[model samples]
Target: MCRTTVANPMMNEPWQRLPALSLKQLQYFVTLAQLRHFTDTASRLAISQPALSSALRQIETVLGVSWSTVPLRRSL
Candidate 1:
């Protein structure tokens, strides 16, 4: 019996250029989303609030998405 392997077509597309996201950055995003509080998220991640904010900004810039500016239920 012979087996065939399939390749992802999208990977060869020229327009598939996408920015990379770090694992740490992704973790920060998920934690912030779940906690809904910058201070709390920072504390949970063992980082300063400003550091967390900066990391989030970097992620936003890389993905070209605005999340911090979005209106959401959060506590300072």
Candidate 2:
């Protein structure tokens, strides 16, 4: 008999090109991605809209990618 454990993919940094990302920032990113609504995500995260935006910005800074704009909505 053998026992095996699967490692967490996110915890493994296969590449060292980008800076390390914090779990909080990733949470903000993932939450916003899932909800696609800043107000709702902010409410779910129990943080102000501005705080959510800030966390997202921090994530972008760490990854050096423009995940999305901070406006949170399109003026269509």
Candidate 3:
């Protein structure tokens, strides 16, 4: 009996550090993107507006972006 094993692509690739993004942060980003309004997004997420803003800021830091340059589709 002969057995052939397939090598995993990921196993051959160099290990890379991933961004420190959380599920909650992604949810915040998607909700804000859909609503296009900070207040509305916060309300929909059951979180405070300031908290939402802080989460976005964290996302910006992780992704190396500025909200002023992001064109969020609504006034922050």
Between candidates 1 and 2, which one is better according to TM-score? 1
lDDT tens digits, residue span 8-58, model 1: 998988657778888999899889888878899999999999999899889
Lowest lDDT 10-residue stretch of candidate 3: 11-20
Model 2, range 4-34, lDDT digits (tens) per residue? 9997777666664457778887788888877
Please list the C-alpha lDDT of all candidates, in the order they appear. 0.86, 0.79, 0.84
- Per-candidate alpha-carbon RMSD to the true structure: 7.5, 8.8, 6.8
Candidate 3 wrongly placed segments (more than 4 Å)? 1-18, 74-76
Backbone clash pairs for candidate 2 read none
- Evaluated against the true structure, the overall lDDT of model 1 is 0.86
Clashing pairs counted in every model: 0, 0, 0
**TM-scores, one per candidate:** 0.69, 0.62, 0.69
